[model samples]
Target: SAPVAAAPGDNYVVDDALTGSRTRWFDEARFGMFIHFGPYAVYQGQYGSCRDAEWIKRQCNISWSDYEAKAASFNPASFDANAIVQLAKQAGQKYIVITSKHHDGFAMWPTRVNRWNLRDHAGFSRDLLRELKDAATANGIKLGFYYSIWDWHDPDFVGNFPAYVTKMKAQLQELVTNYDPALLWFDGEWTETNPTNPWSEQNGEDLERFVRTISPQVITNNRIGKRRLVDGDYGTPEQSLAGSPPSAQLQETCLTINNTWGYAAWDASFKSPTQLVRDLATLTSNGANLLLNIGPTPTGTVSAGQSGALTGMGTWMAVNGAAITGAGYTGLVGQPSWGKVTRKGNKLYLIVNSWASTLHLSRRSPFTVTGARVLGSASPVTVRAAGDGYDFLPSGGATNAIATVIEADIATPA
Candidate 1:
């Protein structure tokens, strides 16, 4: 994705806020946790197989009213928002984007606008997001909200989107006003793509002026209207996202830590620590950030499997993230290997996709590397100067071989 420029001035916007500092901060801290939790986990074994998270209730044929009743069962007494954020921090995450309101229209917070939120139905009167926000801030993590604009139960919106743009604006106003969010991640305009897209029609550019007021300084994402909407601070690519670097303009991939974004008891298509590390590295190399996803159980705690994966990723970043953070790629065009690369000052962080005995250095940038080292370990790896670059000879007590960090000062292409 190319850089999306925001209208410069009083309010700077571009896919997401990528100020020199934000960019530097994001580049240094490459991984983040994308959380999605709701009433879906309760039906883990309802059918013959564990349902794909996004469609559990719908597949079970549960009525809207009946599903609402499950809100009381949504008690995640063990749901420790602080623990989750702490896990992300330990996993080397710089930020956490939790879903305050998904398509099901279940508000994680007790909204003044409606009582149909998790507080009323789930018998849990606590403001879930408030706690999350506090925990995230306390842990020094940037906070963001995953709010689906396409509300299935919001009669004003959904299929009646355009007709209710006024009401939709009101809801957005409430969302933006109530919570000072870092990013407003929206989804579900295409039924073929988003499970409940048909529930809400795609109303284009409806919140430009409204959002301008609520938090003009706030960041936004793609999927609003046209590609122009991509002008919101950052470009968000979903599960299709794997390897890509953090662009100067800001780019993020919202991928599930597990195969499914929602919680399903038997869904075990989770990516291994190797695949996860490689993907994170590749995204940095390609110029993007990885928003690893986690679907919390119906009661609110992230599953054990999800927890393990995130912690593993965090462990890797805690050591090797130096290259992934605080840098932009040199746009090494024609490089066959599609992986993420990050750069800061003179340091080039190459995130390898698959472990290789013989590492080939692509000649694109013209800058010569003065040195090389594995990310987490301070011990320098051996790399012989190639024709235009250097050849890295792999050696170490290899932590998951998927994403081995190669640090160097890349030669600037002439």
Candidate 2:
């Protein structure tokens, strides 16, 4: 069937097949880079137990006037767009999403509606988003933008809700026209409710309509309003993967490289590449994408620690990425005690993150194993048919290794 055209000002009805194509693209993309850079990076200050270091104003109870003052000196001279994109490419990421606007109400791009933008207020004068967009395109990576609905610094937000919404729409229009992002990630919709709060369900519907009208092909997340499962193009479960995959809906799990989403100079805790690789397998097996985040330094350099971790993950991804990309949840229920499983067609990927004497499977399956081999190496594994299941026998003693990808060809009962 042909797609019906939307009225001039009405929301476009996305074709079901187009939506599925978008979901399939997202599912196969598998990994992406999430960035949380803004004026907050200038003050990598910490608070006790507050993970969102980016929300420094709210967490520290700083006055809006004082917080806005930081923009005057917010100059990240070392921000290298090409370098960042290259690093993400090396990490085997397919896309990059950065904060275009945060709760601070400062637009990273030049905006006709707001004077408090990168060129005017931050005084950086360079269009950061444009640089990243070009770099991403050159590197064959998709570009996405993150925008916040809650504006603490916008004066009209205090009392005039309609005016604020108008301003938001205008600013978004600039983003759509100037940057042309593939994804629009909205945040800060769960702020305190007031008469002027523009995050009601109906308002969310309207905002999504505005977005679709501007960029018909852009995908949006569920944070437009209350972030209900039905609100947006995909589900965004932050910091953790969903226990069960959503029925026929897209899902992406966003996790920070460290404890905080924004740069925290004092925050030394970081996830090892091995743990992240294992996590990648675990999340992909459940039919989800992992959006790993990194908060760049105040001067806009990717921290050595973060870069090293990404490099390590790149090494692992170079070999084991076949188990992630183009893979989805297996028909089998529940996770294996030894490792996880990702499937594509009749191929089963046994992801082993830990060494075990034996590997187990679900008690019941309708498939018979034909062959098995370890990924990245010619090492062979022994697979034997057990009643209603199978057992994997490893050939070597590489238990201390980061992860092992075992590929198996299984014929499903038709």
In order, candidate lDDTs are: 0.66, 0.80
lDDT of 2 at 167: 97
**Which candidate number would show the highest lDDT if scored against the true structure?**
2
Instruction: Please give, for residues 69-121, the per-residue lDDT of candidate 2 as tens digits.
Output: 77668888899999999898988889999999888888888888978887888
Tell me the lDDT of candidate 1.
0.66
Report the Cα lDDT for candidate 2: 0.80
Model 1, position 178, has a per-residue lDDT of: 74
The TM-scores of all predictions, comma-separated, are 0.83, 0.91
Which stretches of model 1 miss by more than 4 angstroms? 1-29, 45-50, 158-164, 191-202, 226-231, 242-249, 332-341, 352-358, 376-384, 393-402, 410-414
What TM value does model 2 have?
0.91
**Residue 360, candidate 1: how far off, in angstroms?**
3.6
